[model samples]
Target: MKNDKADFIPIFDGHSLAGWHPVPRLPVSRAPGEPSPDPDDERYRRAMQTTGKWTVEHGAITGRQDPPGCGYGGYLLSDGVYGDFELLFEARPDWPADTGILVRASSLGSQGFQILLDHRRSGNIGGIYGNGIGGFHGINFTLDAKYDEHGRPIGLRLEDPAAAIEPMTPDKPALLDDAATGEQFLSRWKWDDWNEFRIRVEGASPRITVHINDGKISEIDTEALKHPLYNAAAVRDLLGPKGHIAFEIHDNDPGMGEARWGANAACRWRNIRIREL
Candidate 1:
C-alpha cells in the first residue's frame, strides 16, 4: 500500500539499509571552529570519503552529519543505474536541513537533476537544481519557516525570510493556491511532518516533473532550458543516457549565516519505490 502501484519496485526495506551505499559530500571541508583545508590534499580526501553517517530509525532511513552537529554530510546512492523513471518517497527533515533526491546522477561529474527539499530559511522543495553539471537553478520560488525566539522552528511561511514576523499558527490550513499558480506547493507541504514527493525523469536531456503533497511545483525540460549557464549538449555528455538515483545530506556552508542543517538533525525517508518509464 505504500508504493505507487503493485508494479513499482521497492528501493528501501524500511528496517535497514540494504541496496544503498553512502558517498560523502564534497571533500571541501568546513566545520565550525576549523579553517577549511585543501580538498586535493590526500588526507582530507581520504578522510571525507567516509565522513557521512547514515542509519535506520523508526522504520525510516535517516542521514545526519557524523559526530552529531559538528561533522559534514554525504549521500546514499542506489546500486543500480536507471535511465528514466518515476520515483516516489516520503521525507521529514528536522528543521533547517538541506536535502534532495537525485535523478540519473552521474558519479563522474556529480551531474544530476536534484529535486530539492531544502527546508531552511530561503530554501525550497520540489524544484530542480543543476548540481555540478551547470550550477544553475530552475526554480520559481522559495520557502522560509517561522522560528521561535530561540531559533526553533514553530511553523512554515511562504513569504520571504526578511518579512516582518507577525503572529501565526500552524494549526490552520494555508489558503491553498490553484494548481495553475505553481505556488500551491509550499502551502500544501506539512510543517514538521512527513510529505510525499513524486518525480518523473525522462529523455537524454531529461524532462523532469515534480509534485509534492499532490501539488505540482515544477516541470523542466532540460533540452529547452532557458538559463544562460545551461548547455544541453554538455550536460547530456556528462550525464550520459543512464545513471544512478541518489539521496543527499548536503554539505554545510557557514558563509550563508547559520549552518544550513540543524544541530544533530537528521533527514528521514521511508517507503521508497520507483517505476521505470
Candidate 2:
C-alpha cells in the first residue's frame, strides 16, 4: 500500500491527463437567456476553447462543465512553476460545481491565486481569489450553503459563513466581515462527500492559508493587503518566486460577476499532491 503524502508529490497520475493543459475561456458574463459572443466567432473561440471535460476516471481529476449549466468554461493548467507550496487535494462535487485551485498559475498571462472549489449555494469552498488582479483581490470566508430556488444544496449547513473584501477594484461594493471562521468551516466541511483541500503559500507578499474538512478557513497576508491596489511594484509577477499549478473550470467570467456557481457545475480531484515549502 502507498497511502502517499510522504512529502507530497503525486500531482495526479491515477490515470492520465499528463501534466495538464487546456485553458482558454474566461470571457464570462451572458446569462439572462445567454448566447452572445460572436466576435467573428472562430466557432465561438473553438467552443469557448473546449470548455470542460478533462477526464481520468476512478483515480480522479475530472472537471465536467460543458452544456450542463450555462456560462464561463475552460480551465485545467499546470505544466510546472511553483514557489512556496503545500497544496493537498480530494475535492468532490458532482453537478453544482464551479471549482478552483490555482496558485501562481500564469498559463501565459491568465493569472492566479484562486483556491475556491465552490460547492454552489453562495459557494466559497475555502476562498482566496486574485485572478488576473483587479479587485478580484482575495479573501472570502464562505459556509452559507442553504440554497433552494433552482440552485440545490438545501441539505442545510449554515451557521453564518459570509465574508467578502475584494480590495483593489471590481467596482468596489463587497465588504462584509463576521469572522468566527463560519463555525470553523461548518465543522470541517463534507457536504455530499469527500473534502480535504489544504493550501499554504509563504512569503514575498503572499501569505495565504486555507483548509477545509481539515478546518482553518482563511489567513491571507499579501503584505497586509487591504486594497487600493496594494502595490509592490504593481503585482510583481503576481508576487512571484515561481508559479503554475491551476485547475478551475469557472466560466461566466464577467470577472467574478458574483453568483459564483450553479450552472453546469462539476469538480472532482483525487489525491492531488504537492509540497515545496
lDDT of 2: 0.63
TM-score of each: 0.83, 0.29
Clashing pairs in 1: none
How does each model score on lDDT? 0.71, 0.63
Q: How close is candidate 1 to the true structure, as a TM-score?
A: 0.83
Give the top-scoring candidate (TM-score).
Answer: 1
Off by over 4 Å in 2: 1-49, 52-64, 69-73, 76-95, 101-103, 108-112, 121-124, 127-144, 147-180, 184-205, 209-217, 220-247, 250-277
RMSD of each: 7.2, 20.0
For candidate 2, give the lDDT of residue 68.
Answer: 49
Off by over 4 Å in 1: 1-4, 27-49, 149-151, 161-183
lDDT tens per residue, model 1, 111-171 = 5778888877667677677776564565555567777899777877675535523212221
